[model samples]
Target: MVFQARCEYGMRMTSAPDPFHIQEELKYLRLHITNFLSYQSAVLDLADLVALVGPNATGKSNAVAAIKLLREIPIHGLPIAIARRGGFDQLRHRSSGRPYNPALRLDFQFGDNPVSFYELKLRGMEGKRYEVKQERGVLHFKGDKYAFTNNAGTLGFTEMEGGHRSRVSGDRKIPVPAGQSAVSFPATFGLFIVARVLQLMQTVEINPALVGELQEPSSTREFEPDGSNTASVFEELTSETRAELVDELSAIVPGIQRIELRRLADKVTLAFVQELSEGKRREFLAKQMSDGTLRAFSILLSMLQESRPALLVIEEPEIAIHLGALRTLVDIMRQQSETTQVLITTHSADIIDTIDIDALRVVWSEDGASRIAPVAEHTREPVRQGLITPGQLLRSDSLDPASA
Candidate 1:
């Protein structure tokens, strides 16, 4: 909860907007991964809305997995995050029968502030053990730059003083667990930006599997990543938000008259109302709704939350949904991206066509290594000239990345 306290202090001292407020903008600009998963090296020049289109096994999901891991670092520490994904050896990129260490770098910008960055490198030790090779963060506030670093187990801090960057206040030995990151330090030594970075990252949420399953309502109002708590979250929404949600859902699914939160004694669930002939209506419980309907509802609910995350990653959102509904989903996602950085991985041609050309990054493999880049000029030309649509190009397996 260090970041939580620091977040409140930061807003009070600077009189800045709350970081979680939907109107505030704090977003990731780029993500660079080296020797992680199947990607020997890959870079995603993130935009407000980005679509990763590629053939299966081409490493689209790997890119998402990398970001998800970073999001969990501050929450679970470095060791457990790695363990949750198997282990360091399994995550490291392998070549020629040897595993290589993996490194991750993320660039972020908040409002008009200077671009800040956090970089992490994990080293593999003998006997399959792993340690934090390096963890660093730099944040610029007002006119001063604050830098924090942990080279191996040595924790250090530096700041801009009198116009020149120097190790001010000398170095102090800080005890940081070998398996933890320096960014998760309990006392940030007034380097609020360091805590801010962790706070921002902790807000990241990824789409969960089986998004449509019925849930036992709880008091927690926030949308859970797996969407199991969706009914409770929906019940907490303001009447205006509920109306807006229904309007959008009706556009996407049609015949969706409204959605109601039904509570029976100690149990709570959702009731999807559909209009029928002569102003008649039919009601379907959460368990009775189709998978596609439930999935769409869950996704829409996540995007409509009053407190949006810094980053949202969704994989293959088009699955089990009709083409028409997919279009509406894409539109809503695009609008939501204005408030949060939205990254999606999909093989759906309809998806490629709905997104802007500049928002598309094509993932492909070369010599068994994953590579990603904007659509190649040559490959994107036909779509640009209106001779071929992105959907058509995707279907033909011709969505190639531009040459470096």
Candidate 2:
């Protein structure tokens, strides 16, 4: 009866909130990787807005892939996440004389409390597959503590009233499937902290190519990572937010007057209304829009959503974007970072120039492995002193991590 009341008013409810609104109290601090892609071992310190800058093959994309992997684990479970990346064999680094297993650790903080962490280690098995070698996590939030550990598929969980692990009735031993993570298992005991951690791990990876595809109608209002459901998502925004989005898009594209959602049969798509002249108007379907227009529109829509993800990762968003619009794009990202962490991988000098030196992290190759760190003090000093832009330093190869 309650659900029917909401349905009559066009409200949608689910087992969990759609388009999870990341709590502002939670913030990611660091990402540690081992034997993943070009990284033999690396730690990236995260800021609200991180601009991952480097030459090609420096492992910028690898870092982004790692975060995406973490995001998938909670939703798709461990085995599928591994399979989606072509199995563990392809993901493990091929460095000579080093361990073949790949591991990842993410550190996060809830407000000013002690840091919380989740770690996962995988071991290669026969048939070019992998199994969970070990997994553990400790989370302290709102006066409740939850901790879980899984060693070789043996799972243990504890819930307590304080930060220290207290042996409560929830403490129990079980065997998780070799291919699963206890934290990702829906029926795990003491799942409050694990669920909160995974909720904050929610991430969206925007692909302009996917965002440009034609969309079909759906009842869901949640924005997807690849933005395939953009038209429907945009259609659900409140009128005030839609107005703001249209105004922002017009500023970026110079002629866009409004955005209209069109539906035909089961198909749904966006149409851009442009005022060609004082009395002349033109309409273009999303298919007819320029790549730059589509890309910018997708980004703005994500930023304007009522509920935002914990992390927004965009790879080479500069592609197909006008140089003049780069500042506008960066500005929106900066504003969005106040509510959601933004991570971008790019080689665009304009993007580097638009962001601050503190937000810059340089990725480079050292000893045939990728290493990442904050920009060198030398390069940072010049940029901070206003002697030259970070973009100039990037073009001259002065932002190399080796010099740090």
Candidate 3:
């Protein structure tokens, strides 16, 4: 039940519109994993559109989480919140002991005319504050190579072919210390390319259908990780655009029509105004819509309208959606993939049943080791015959069989 699929390699994907520009070719990105969950070893070339499915706890979300964590590290990798959460000790595989022996590593290759490759090895150490034990950073491009200019806990670089890179700390020349990830070292001295790549690789794009956002209140504004921004976003739309969106949305979602955002005595809230025949009206305040319906709309709007992002990870989308919405969600998901590489962890058989089987990778976890297996028609038989539903299978005991 653990999805494991070997990441296909030795192939080239023509570049996409530059992610930096709305219409320019998005830079083609290749997300590869040599050894990851349910895969004795696996590597996957994420395409513009792809889908993944497996039983609950079979490690479906874990795969997406792994990718999310990787992209987040160089940025917020060292946030104080992590330390508060039991420090770096809690960062590694919970099952694996100190040293986090089998650390996950990611290799990146970018550019053209010359081409280049960079690798990041994540090593966790034993200490009150979990620190990185080793990081070997290098750049190979234009028939020349440079080593990780090392500094105190950071990785750095200098003139490879007389071209000055981004500046680091202290001076206009020096390598990064070993203590910090070369990817995250401040861009004062020089490691600019690495800096740019890390900057560009900021967020993980999630499959729209499965993405969820819960409402949270705060004095300040923030991008809701779960995407609770639809009503807020709609409130700002032009009257014409707002009307079109609501009209189309209500047609698909049923239960009447119209939506209004109110600034009440102290806070902002959404109101769903429904009209039965002949002006027979009803108002299901944001407080009135089912948690699931509100969540569904928020998820749909965010995915359908996001301007740009580094990556997106959609967790089990089938949870709250009806069968009819499932198909509509799929249509939009594939359309977005044309410009963004979206990853999804889902369990809805109805959704996957209609997808290209090869697009999915079943995942399984055991003894802290995760494996990814490609879902062949044959593989689905066991999952189908377990005579089980996703709800029951996810909560099953005896799942961590040590050597899955």
Error of 3 at 60 (Å): 2.4
lDDT values, one for every candidate: 0.74, 0.76, 0.47
Q: Which stretches of candidate 3 lie over 4 Å from their true place?
A: 1-24, 27-44, 74-87, 94-99, 102-118, 133-152, 158-179, 185-222, 228-230, 235-248, 255-257, 277-281, 305-307, 366-368, 377-404
Give one digit per residue, the lDDT tens place, for model 3 in 1-404.
11111112212122222323422333434444433333223444455555665556755554554455454445454343234334454444444332342234444443332323334444544454444444444544433344454334543444343244432222333344333455454342123343344333322232222222223333222224454444455555567755655655564567547777766665556677777568688887676666556555654454444334434556766666788876666666666666555667776667765455446655665555555655545444555676543334334531222123
C-alpha TM-scores of all predictions: 0.88, 0.90, 0.66
Residue 266 displacement (Å), model 3: 3.8
Best model per TM-score: 2
RMSD, one per candidate, in order: 4.4, 5.3, 9.9
lDDT digits (tens) for residues 214-268 of candidate 1? 5577665556766777778787788999999999888888889888888766767
| Top of the candidates by lDDT | 2
Ranking by TM-score: 2, 1, 3
lDDT of 1: 0.74
- Please say which candidate is ahead in lDDT: 1 or 3: 1
Candidate 3 achieves a global lDDT of 0.47
Backbone clash tally (model 3): 64
